[model samples]
Target: MNKHLLADRVKALTPSSTLAITAKAKELKAQGVDVIGLGAGEPDFNTPDHIIEAAYESMKAGETKYTPAAGTADLKKAVSQKFEKDQHIAYSPDEIFVGSGAKHVLYCLFQAILNEADEVIIPTPYWVSYPEQVKLAGGTPVYVEGKESNHYKITADQLRAAATEKTKAIIINSPSNPTGMIYSKEELSSLAEVCVENNILMVSDEIYEKLTYGEEKHISIASISEEFKKQTIIVNGVSKSHSMTGWRIGYAAGEKAIIKAMTNLASHSTSNPTTTAQFGALAAYTGTQQPVEEMRAAFEGRLNQVFDSLNAIQGFRCLKPQGAFYLFPNVKEAAVSCGFTTVDEFAADLLEKANVAVIPGSGFGSDDNIRLSYATDLKSFKEAIKRIAAYVNEHSSASD
Candidate 1:
């Protein structure tokens, strides 16, 4: 083997199918085909003007030097205050570490905490990066299924069955990515107790906490108790909540020792997050929250307008998601009934024939479904649903 070759780690990693599908849609559009892409998980709204102004001011003031690897004092204070006000938990600045994005924060976290051979329990269908990050940190990823009937949430009993002596951490994503299901306070309490009893660290990903519909509320698992708090690391940022995805600021708050270790690791990897972006995040936490509420309302309205029509598509059964902007509908029967061998093939065929792009559930640890993000305009989203229904109606008849 050549010593100049790619590292084994990079070779073993799987490229994100979500990004692949989105790019394919873009490719077709570049060639002049009409395509509706439902694979992106980003908001269509722009970042608020106040946040943008703050970042511009920071740059104009020549505050462009590298900040402390952990974070600037102002941004850290903002994160601390946000946590206390929203989650009923308080963290000193020393307990927090901000990174380029929530995704980067999570990577640094696994690197700081995991020993080789340690296991991280992840609930499925999870975000595409969870297991991959664990692998990159040399930790084993143990998956426990979150069944469809429970709206794709895991039970405390299932969590207990998956824990072991080598279990080092558990990741909880509330207002989850693909399924958009949120665990209630009662559900969170039981899961928190299991983690506490097992001395397992909990990594709560609350990136989508701001977008929920009706009675479903997002709860921070770390807020369950002081004991739970001591063992939990709450990870979040302004990407989803403030439409600041491009601004690239996310953070982790937890026990001082772990946060310090993550901060040290971050110093060697990506030096502190972008300075201007940190100021933007500071404004995101302190400025008027009306923009956040308005965006949430818009997502809720989109969900209401598209849910029934999406579920009514032939051979598809979709649960009304309680939060976030995604809908994961079981399409295994639909796929087979439509003469496609799998959801992946069906998704490809939809893109090729109806010019619709969707991320198949096989990428999210479930082959029976496909995930759709309603973060685009309601007019386009409704049209996508119509195209999906037309595709299913036209193809599923072959099964009869």
Candidate 2:
């Protein structure tokens, strides 16, 4: 194959730094290194047994054939009911479409909506995939910084400043990845108004809705009003809620026109999401809420413990995230105190010397922070934190 013949779009694409660093960590672990990896974003729990059993039952009943391009009607209806049951947002089956995972659902959405020269406003410290997906769909990503002082969430005015005639959409993630901060109902309403005023679509990624800690509750912006309902599209999945990441099931619910367009695109591209996975997802939406609660409690427990540990390190500043299972700490001062040139360099040194793996903040569009996942066991997480604290202390320039 001639390398030159590859499409320019494919050539220009940026690979996911999180996955790359994760792979590197795995390689080191395979060689028997005592590497403590805190890079994964998924829950470590297994799929709830009931959901697994339902998929088995479906397969035994010969439900393994290709489902509708959007999803099986039964699964679609379950997703719709789940929305109303959990978020109080109502939608019909025609407005719902399940795909391979939330990521795939988002990809198809961008492909369906974006055209050349269009722009999508994305908040900084974003999930790594948002910009790349927008670019892949031939749209530009306009970044609006969610200041650290503001708990890493941009205000309505900042969003307004970023919108342009070519702007087509905005991506909002609650219990956001990297930061784990959730937007309050008031904040969502203000931003929703901006989207309405601009006639821009709100792409809400709520995959981490079930993992929030403390008094934090996840709210859907679309639930604010009928007008917001029209302006918003929700992308979510059973992956996080059911600890079924490997099962590969996610869905989108929104305006019928967009759902139909995504369904047609999916029909041609994927034919259908994996047949068995859709059945598994159906069980997840309709299954018992007990397992989800158990996992959430476990995550909540880990978050508080890890949050305290993170802030204890000298020069390390971290917010107690309201949701999600990761910690994003501003380690710029810590990195500088240790005489490292950049956070990326400090991260590399930590992985090699301390045998601890964390993602550099640069990949998430912030160069002064590092992301640590508390998805692993409490024991291992403490050990990782201990090693990090020791390394930074031992190498402090002030000490020397």
Candidate 3:
């Protein structure tokens, strides 16, 4: 006799391709293959010493048990102070809810708000989990394509077009995942005007808020206008900024009612982030930013190195990213010229032949691109690009 039961929701969801590729690279590495993985989403840097020390201190002080559903009062106050200092937005302690990670906070938000057939507008080349999370919350995901000419940023026109009565929310991730594209203040203003007119909820995922490079200033969409602030949920964490991914600490600031609902959801799900992690995050927010700045500088330097190397290859088109440590190159020209019919095939062949693991853009809702994370050291960046360039040049049918 066979006994099997799985929820339809669980069965219907597709596993994350980003995580899948990372796992595949791990499998090959265990077999002693020299696979260079460019698919990671977290920083390669270690958590700063001060943050670790804070966690240790917390544990020693008996802060190992559960706290409030929202978060520890100290961490919440620290998060509130951070928003005031950095974004110039003031959030009360009641307006913040912390969870296992920004990802978990996002999941709880969706779970709290979304109902059957509710629609969420997501820009293409988005983070891999956005659509899946929406689906799990019983919401329909409406993807609006952002073009390369626009730096893959969704326009006000697109926002206006995608809005409908069933629309519940729209996700905006600047210094976006897969593509390190950022929305300027003027651009966000335009989108905010549309959101304001339409009365739609904006979920701003700013996990990479502090990882921006160069002169590009990260703007919070809520900070654009009072109405926008009222409708927006700003999701942030110490994961990317402080290299604290494993700490599982992230928070959301928004309307008191929404925060309350999210906190209620968190209480049932995880019942607050780890006590030690909250203490660590508190330290991260209160500590000096020298470590964060050092990491950002290294990422910026590596970005330039990777861009120059990839551009030297035939048929590879790259856009210089303003923030984050990712390069989403348009490989369509190279893929076609190299006799590959699709981006997936191009990526698969490269992984099999060159042993370099990169995520295909199809996973991020684009068809003719592939994402490379430059979070590793310069040596790995150079070697990975060298292998990629050599493989592309050798495999090109145009060379014949």
Candidate 4:
């Protein structure tokens, strides 16, 4: 008999549906299908010229040697200053760890902290990777569902009910992935109180910190109190803010001990983020705010256009998002009325018939929704929505 080899954890893991959809969209586009993809998560903007120049200069200066496992001192200090300036949360250089991206830093933290059977409280409609990463780290993911009535924000009572003696941490993604719902200061304080009382570590993903719309300021849970800061890990980066996703530089600020452990894990796994990327990220932190604000304004304008267009369609319910570039509209009513059994079917049909690609809500732990990224050019955005609206209207009278 042939020998079979595979780790049980690896065998049990599910493929990322979001990435799968993105890949399929790309495949269709490559085949000259005129695919309008609303599934991409990253910004469509290019990295700023100044930041790109910094990376070019670094290469010329031969700053190619490997740096510290965590990051170079300059980058770490830049990250420290960023927290102080933006979030009003102070952090020492020792409390910072730089990784390839916020995603990598989060994975390393989980690998260091989670033990077998440890429970992690995650709010639903979360980023697709949260639960899978927890499972890969040998932790159990306990989901707390957020409803539309509350603007998709989970309540303190919900967090309390999901907690147990075995619970180790809670993942909080304000300006959340699928819904783009941000927790207000009051809401964050209430949830922080629960975590403080229960001794739960809070992993706050603030990657989209600068992309908020209107008066909805992004509040860091760590900024609420020193006690909360001690238990909270603030994960952020320049990917969304500076449109530097391809640069692959992200960092986390937290208690010195936890940061140290994450750095040690990095030492063994990936030694450090690319030297050039770190230099570019440092420039991103120190550069002027004009580019960042420009991108934010564009996203805000596009967001309004998409939100209004989606709300006009029959059987579609949408809430105006306060942050992030994506609009997640609930299409359950449309699914039921148009003979589609699930959001997945709705998305697939739209792609086939309307030639528009979107991510199904089930990928983001939502069953009745679909996420549409308006990160493309305005012309493409308008055309895609027009096609989508027409298709839904034409199919609206069908019975499931």
TM-score for each model: 0.98, 0.98, 0.98, 0.98
Per-residue lDDT of candidate 4, residues 275-370 (tens digit): 999999999998887999999999998887667877888888999989988888999988877788888998999998899999999988889999
Q: What tens-digit string does per-residue lDDT give for candidate 3 at 1-400?
A: 2235777788879889989999999999999999999999889999999999989998999988889998988889999999989888989999999889999999999998999999999999899999999999999999999899989998999999989999888999997997898999999888888887888889999988888877887999988777889989999999999999899899999999989999988888787788898999999999889999999988988887678888778888888888888999999989898888899999988888999999999999998999999888889879999999899889898777
Report the candidate with higher lDDT, 1 versus 3.
1
How does each model score on lDDT? 0.93, 0.92, 0.90, 0.90
Write candidate 1's Cα lDDT for 1-400 as tens digits: 8876988777879889899999999999999999999999899999999999999999999999999998899999999999989987989999999999999999999999998999999999999999999999999999999999888999999999999999999999999999999999899999999998999999999999999899979989888788889989999999999999998899999989999999999999888999999999999999999999999999999999899999888789999988989999998988998888889999999999989899999889898999999999999888988998888888896535
Angstrom error at residue 270, model 1: 1.2
Q: Give lDDT: candidate 4, residue 48.
A: 92
- For model 2, the superposed segments whose C-alpha errors exceed 4 Å read 1-3
**Candidate 2 lDDT, tens digit per residue, 246-290?**
888999999999999999999999999988888888888887889
Per-model tally of clashing residue pairs: 0, 0, 0, 0
Any residue pairs clashing in model 4, and if so which? none
Better of 2 and 4 by TM-score: 2
